[model samples]
Target: MTGLLALAAFEQPMKRFAVLLGIGSTVCVVQGWTLAAMLFSLPFCVIWAYCGWLRTEPQLKWLNLMFAALYIYGLARHIWWTN
Candidate 1:
């Protein structure tokens, strides 16, 4: 799964959005924008999770599912508490 993600970094289609979103997420994190970073990464995680499901890859599927859950939790917290 780790190797798959590494190779996806160089592969097309996946490369296009994944790499850009990854960089954007990193930039947001560096700028101390936690919510923005999660927003950027959420789609990436969801997409990979779906791909993992389609491919029947449990590790990738569960890992991304967990990440997506965390991001959702964080976003919900930010939204509910920031008001």
Candidate 2:
């Protein structure tokens, strides 16, 4: 994901927005604000992926699903089933 973001920096005009999402997610994860990140990233990535954004190769196509699952799991674990 970091790699993709780095690549986005080089070739994407939308990199600034992507960077916002990425950094926001990273900060939420580090701060254990899982639900906040999940709320932001799930919809963001889905839309970002569907719009042919990111400009990634075919091999990385499944990244959207992976990111969705990540947020789902994080929300479930951190917010729904908290310790």
Candidate 3:
């Protein structure tokens, strides 16, 4: 689920690059490499989400929020609880 969430983030021109990184991050997350995933995907996800908000696209807005939440949860889980 987290992987899929991460996979949803992308933008044109950089879409292909972002997708590849997103997939790698998703794989890291799925493999219990939460730290690596967070370090890798957090920036891209933030940028993606912010870009979504900058546009008039309603779907991207909500979808990015959802993905952001999932990323946050994943980060928090690793930070405060998974320890």
Candidate 4:
């Protein structure tokens, strides 16, 4: 019962996260950060591709880490570019 409820609670957030990442990836691509965009987009792509497999895949976890690191790097580049 509790476990079911926990699963239910997690489901929506994961769905929303997947959608958000998808949109973010699209934005990156549109902005012409091709390589950075691909790096930024990979986790969401994996999320879309694998769906329920995220829980079991260490590579997906590492992909998310790479996404985060790339996102931070992109932010720094943007700030540097604007200045």
Candidate 5:
């Protein structure tokens, strides 16, 4: 009971945080902070992917998963190959 209550309490702030990160990621893109934006958006992509899976939304699931894979690959290449 207490655990469920705690989880419920924690859920909203995390959702809000994820949303802010998404918005901030877009703003980063607009401001030409491409790397920062991608970094911020990775979590958003992952979260949405999970949500899509839980809700059985195939389109959303696949799209987000694809983006997440691409973002991860790009980030890895940038971090490893560039150095």
Candidate 6:
């Protein structure tokens, strides 16, 4: 995710906006704001993945794939953590 963000920061014009949305969504989660974080985080995640898929570098492609796996793992962990 960080790798994707870094790449987006370099290449994408909307990177900053996406990052801001992520931060806001994180804050919402921390503040116990209902399901809004999940919704907000969705776009950031999608954009990250999209940007990663669009990357031309082989190393970045691998990194993106790893990041995506880790992201899914984190989501699964969160479900268990909350339960």
Choose the strongest candidate by lDDT. Answer: 1
Candidate 5 yields a Cα-based lDDT of 0.80
Relative to the true structure, candidate 6 reaches a TM of 0.52
What lDDT, from 0 to 1, does candidate 4 have? 0.62
lDDT of 4 by residue, 1-83 (tens): 34434555465676678788778768878888665565556556545334334445567656666665676676677678889
lDDT scores of the candidates, listed in order: 0.83, 0.66, 0.68, 0.62, 0.80, 0.65
lDDT of 1: 0.83
TM-scores vs. true structure, each candidate:
0.78, 0.53, 0.56, 0.49, 0.77, 0.52
lDDT of 6 by residue, 7-42 (tens): 554555556766987898889889997456765665
* Model 3 C-alpha lDDT versus the unseen true structure: 0.68
Clashing pairs in 4: none
lDDT of 3 by residue, 1-83 (tens): 34434534444645555677789888987999867887668666665665565554668767767777787787788778757
Which residue pairs come into collision in candidate 1?
none
Best by TM-score: 1
Q: Give RMSD to native, each candidate.
A: 6.3, 7.7, 8.5, 6.0, 4.1, 7.2
Clashes of each: 0, 0, 0, 0, 0, 0
Comparing 1 and 2 on TM-score, the stronger one: 1
Candidate 2 residue-wise lDDT, 1-83, digit = tens: 56556644444445456668778877888998868878778766654564344555443446776777887787778765666
- Best-to-worst TM-score order: 1, 5, 3, 2, 6, 4
Evaluated at residue 11, the lDDT of candidate 4 is 58
Count of backbone collisions within predicted model 4: 0
Better of 1 and 2 by lDDT: 1
Better TM-score candidate (2, 3):
3
Residues 1-83, candidate 1: write the lDDT tens digits: 56555655434676468778989999999999998999999988877776786568899989999999999999999999999
